[model samples]
Target: MLRITAGKLAGAMRGALVGNSTRVAAVRSLHGTEESAEEFDKRYEKYFSREGIDGWEIRKGMNDLLGMDLVPSPKIVEAGLRAARRVNDIALAIRWLEGCKYKCGDQMATLYPYILEKVTPTLKELGVPTLEELGYDKPELALKSVYDQ
Candidate 1:
């Protein structure tokens, strides 16, 4: 079943009137085949928008990308890239990276470079020193240093 956490729903809801929105809840499908990413997002917003549904138990899960078994799916990586390009929100990019790092575990190495490349400009805009500025001659070393921090 496709499930979504209330926190992710709230993030999607953005400026909606999410009273006590910090709480997390998981909504799952009872039956029927999993929906497409677009359809799932539509349904998730619809379910979360309804009145009530607060203080529910928060289960670990991801949003959209039904076919994906991995945490840092291409959709998520793209979303982070888009955020970096448009909003340039360092916190958002970092949160995405942290989520992937925490959930993807050893698999994160494969995706880390792509994420770092996408977010580097935003990080620079946010005054985070680059690898060159930090005296790291190599991007991989700089990535490790930044990841460690």
Candidate 2:
């Protein structure tokens, strides 16, 4: 399950990663309001039932992963797949992985091949950019700090 995997991944990366768990807060900010678990679930189900999800949804999910500030592991991917399978929505799962890629940035480089293999066809049909195409195939290490004077 995603919860289990997320927990383990978080545990493994707690000291190694650099982001914060701001999804809950970010969600509330993005929505301009707080939502209860049931409310969120209802909204999520409705969103998933649509023919397609928008970039905002994907970005929000990515922000959540970014908040964790950890690189993704294979187990994390498996957990996401399992969670999506529970809903019988393969596209949604792929979308979630896309979000993971954006959220984790270079940290997801190792996952690009696996993710591409799984979602290439669907993404082509859907006209979504592959992670590699989007320039996520490698880490983007800055040569200079933004604060450099």
Candidate 3:
């Protein structure tokens, strides 16, 4: 809360601060290595498949999954979908698929099919319809203006 300004006082304060500084340029690794993809998958799968998971938790988990830069592994996606099913939110599950599609970018054509292939059996067992089945593969209610037509 103290602000030392100008002249000799400022110089002395700056010197004291720098001398007492405990900050280090080198930081130690907590785990010494990054989490392996398998560890990441198991962690998220456990997170979504925990007992008594609710809609909010499912949404939170989905948001976390989407926020990550990498496309989630199929097991993680299946676990999240199953969590959505546990909460009885078909809409959320569909949105999760959309997020996954967004995460896949141009690779969707290649990756999504495989993701679907992996999760299809689970989707059938859960009775959750995909965005395509719900008619969301195309934009909703496209109207061509007469001027443009």
Candidate 4:
């Protein structure tokens, strides 16, 4: 039987509400490292199994979110940043920044500054260039820059 570790039904619901097909495809693309289809299925199965939710429901929810054709709001981006900060997870912080770049183009100029302020120290500690230096023009490129650095 599946069990939800997060105990946050709202998170799952929100995920469903925002998980559109496009976003799902984007997420899949984000998993760029080569992995077999079986591996991907296993990973998703584990995710759904742990969430105590039906896989189809989750996929449907993702599709619904994608249909909205909206990027994540600033509020969501801020929340993700806060979470990353709290966890001291640089990779997660970078991921959130990348998401903000993808979804909030209007706020890109402002967002980059904010992310730089928060992530710069971490990046320096990890011997990576600032987001501005690496250039946040492309999410995939930014991710690679971070990974390569």
lDDT (Cα, tens digit) per residue for candidate 4, span 61-113: 33443245455443334434444444455565565556545554677567656
How big is the positional error of residue 107 in model 3, measured in Å on the Cα after superposition? 0.7
State each candidate's clash count.
0, 1, 0, 4
Task: Report the lDDT of model 2 for residue 30.
Answer: 79
TM-score of each: 0.32, 0.32, 0.75, 0.31
Report lDDT per candidate.
Answer: 0.46, 0.55, 0.87, 0.51
Ranking by lDDT: 3, 2, 4, 1
Task: Give residue 52's lDDT in candidate 2 (0 to 100).
Answer: 49
TM match of model 3 to true structure: 0.75
The C-alpha stretches of model 1 lying farther than 4 A from their native spots are 1-30, 35-69, 81-88, 114-149
Q: What lDDT is reached at residue 24 by model 3?
A: 37
- lDDT (0-100) at residue 86 of candidate 2? 48
**Weakest 10 consecutive residues, lDDT, candidate 2?**
72-81
Candidate achieving the largest lDDT:
3
- Which lDDT tens digits does candidate 2 get at residues 81-130? 44454455656565666666666567445665665566566555554554
Worst 10 residues of 1 by lDDT: 54-63
